[model samples]
Target: MVSKKQRLASVDALRGFDMFWIIGGEALFLPLFALTGWSVFHFGHGQMQHTQWHGFSFYDLIFPLFIFLSGVTLGLANKSLRGLPVSDRAPVYRKAVKRLFLLILLGVVYNHGWGSGIPADLGEVRYASVLARIGFAWFFAAMIVWHCTLRTQSVIAVTILLGYWLLQTLFGNLTPEGSVNAWVDQHVLPGITYQNRAYDPEGVLSTIPAIANALGGVFAGRWLAHHSGDHKAILKGLFMAATVSLLAGFLWHWVYPVNKELWTSSFVLITCGCCLLLLGIFYLVVDVWHWKRFTYIFSVIGCNAILVYLGTSLVNWQYSSKSLFGGIAAALPQQAAGTFLIACGVILLQWLVLRFLYKRGIFISP
Candidate 1:
């Protein structure tokens, strides 16, 4: 049997792969559209960009995928803590709280906290952030997992989805200013919202539905834990659940509409389904089949995801990349070629930084 203390390679690789897109991996392929003018590259480029309002895109999947994976880690962590005394769990809870607030604080920093010196006014800060959403969803989902049985957790997940849909129907429309989420953010959130708009994608009300994504990951993690030794069982269970989730999501989209901005019920269902599907494939190839070599880069990045995520904001990686590789890009025959080369250089530099941390066992997580 696989030891609970041991990490799942597939999880790390999948996380790094997801983070890849966030850290400009999309640019590597995006420039292809301009260079070759191929329909295929155009389609790939389209997939990299988020849907404007009320649709799904591959880019939309990235945020929830990370949150879902965070839930999976929480589940596995809970499993490891199962046999411990109640008193021993205190530090675990404390650490969870610390991680939650830390991520939230860091999210603030990512939103330009102190970037232009201190904000002259309290309202200058944008408190809603991607990392903050992850922290909130993971924290609430962890609380549910700590208290509830699987069946109860399942019920709660349903309640959250349905309840959010019902509330949206009653109080919110799809518009930026009219969204119930916008109202919530304006009234409750202390500082500025995203782009100083009425609605923040990671705002107060929208976060309620995001918890379902984390819970879905918890369910996946539990399934993996239950069938740790049975590879076939794991694949079958994951695929079956994913199929059901996808069907449900599509069906609900007729009414609620799948949207990443509001993070509607349908959006949560669809993204969670895709996440499960991706996790299943990653597990099959990376873990079940033991294909470990190619995944090393992803594993390194995943090990220190938060670091690179924040690094992109705090550090001038693009400047550094251009400083080192600008001449190389300039020497390329075409502007598109130069753009692609610079993108590659950016990723290479980020990977080297991650590799350095990975080799020295310097992983930093929330």
Candidate 2:
């Protein structure tokens, strides 16, 4: 068996697997339906995109999965920190605060930077971002784990989800212009909404429920860490929790609807369910069955996911792919095949870059 560090491989692999879609791999499927003209490809391609409103899709699950994974890691991180003397806690707290602001700063630059003319375009830029949401939600969840027991943390998560549901149901109008979400963004944030027009998918009020998603991840991490020895027990509990979460989400969906943009309570439950199920499968395979070799590629990407993601955005891998391999892809007869080839080449190029870093034992992380 591997050491304590190796135990984290499953988590890292799972995280990388999720990041695959975000890092251009999802584009690989866009043209697949065109080439095959099969119902399966068409259905999958549709699921790959976000639903316009009030529905579930595979694409909708990616962001929340990141939040959930952070929560899981936080449980492990907090447990280690708890062992330190009280005097040592302050520095860790300070570091976390620094990391928080750094993430917020990065989010700011990502939305409005030198490319967008900096401060001149800041007023119209979408300030709220996926990174900002992850930072905020994970920061709060980390703080909560430092002080609260597992039971208390779980209670807090449930309360947030249920409370948010009640509030939205009572006051939410469920319209683009009239919904409480849009009203708050337009009223409080003004032009800072996504597209600098109306509402942000990762708006302020919606983050309250998002915190619950992270908390659910914390619970998963805690359970896994606690049962690290009894493999059978760990699998059983994970599967059971996944089932319960799935059932609760669908039951609540009738009233609240699983809306990703809103990050609805039901959406939280369902996505967490999917993450749990995925993690359970990964754990059983990599950790129990000892199928470690196949997951190494994912582990490489997951080790520095944040850095690679930011790098992709700043470097504009799309431009690189177009410049370097565009002709190669263009040779294909089917446009769908051509598009899929471009996406494949791009992702493969990214993997090669990441692989080089892995071989050199270099990783950029925050």
Candidate 3:
């Protein structure tokens, strides 16, 4: 039996796999497409990019996947906290709020607000951001988990999804300009809207549904925690849950559509289904079957996921890659090959830094 205190390798590997793309794993296939001119590579490359306005892509899964994983981690971390005396829970709540604000601050910096230099005015800053959304989603989801029972949590998830759907239906449409998300950002949200557009992808109104995504993860986490000793049961339960979620998502898509920018309710259900499905597969392969060798790199990156994310923005990896692998890229036969080499170099350097931190038992959580 796995100890309750033990971390799950599959979770880390899944997170690392998601982070892989954000840190340029998506570009890894673009050169292959350029070199081979094959449909498969072209298709793969396309999947790596976001859908411009509406529709789904492999890339759209990346952000929500991380947010779901954050909820999973939160659910797991709070298992012990939940058992503590009521008075002892204060620290946990404090820590949760602190992490939320810290992530918001980091999100601003990640957007180059403070990192680039002080903005001329508050309006110059783009406050709605990827990290900020994660913060809000995880924070509210954590609050739900901390106070509610499994049944209550599930009900709340449904309520939030339905409520969000209703709100969007009444106030928003699926266009970049007409999106309720865009409207809220432009009129209500502080700081300039993302790219000075009508809407920010990570804007305020859309986060309502995103909290449901995190709650889905919380549910998954609580389930795993409840059944830690039975791997087979866990596998069966996850697969079955995923099947239902996916079915519901597809059915709902006929009405709501799976729009990533708006983060439609259907998008939440579909992505959470994917997340659960992926978690189950990873659990079966890595945790249940004990096939650990190939996933080592992902696990390494996963252990220090936050550090690498912040590092990519804070550090000049492109310059470093060019310094180290410029000659190699220059020596390549084709421009595509050179571009691919440099992309790989950038990923390699980041992975090496993550590996160093992982080896030294250093992990940045926030």
Using lDDT as the measure, which candidate wins? 1
Clashing pairs in 3: none
Give me candidate 3's TM-score against the actual structure. 0.94
Better of 1 and 3 by lDDT: 1
Per model, state how many residue pairs clash: 0, 0, 0
- Any runs in candidate 2 off by more than 4 Å, and if so which? 1-7, 78-86, 114-122
Task: List model 1 lDDT by residue over 168-230, tens digit each.
Answer: 889878788898988988899888877778988999999999999999999998888778879
The pairs that clash in candidate 1 are: none
Off by over 4 Å in 1: 1-6, 80-86, 114-116
**What's model 2's overall lDDT?**
0.80
Clashing pairs in 2: none
Across 25-122, the per-residue lDDT of candidate 3 in tens digits comes to 88878898898889898999889988886578989999999989887876665454456687889887888899889988888888888324554577
Q: Give me the candidate number with maximum TM-score.
A: 1
- lDDT of every predicted structure (CA atoms): 0.87, 0.80, 0.84
Q: Name the TM-score of candidate 1.
A: 0.95
Q: What is the C-alpha RMSD of each candidate to the true structure, in Å?
A: 2.2, 2.7, 2.4
Model 2 Cα lDDT, one tens digit per residue, 147-214: 78777888898899988878777776666665678878877763367765467887888888989989
Which prediction has more favorable TM-score, 2 or 3? Answer: 3
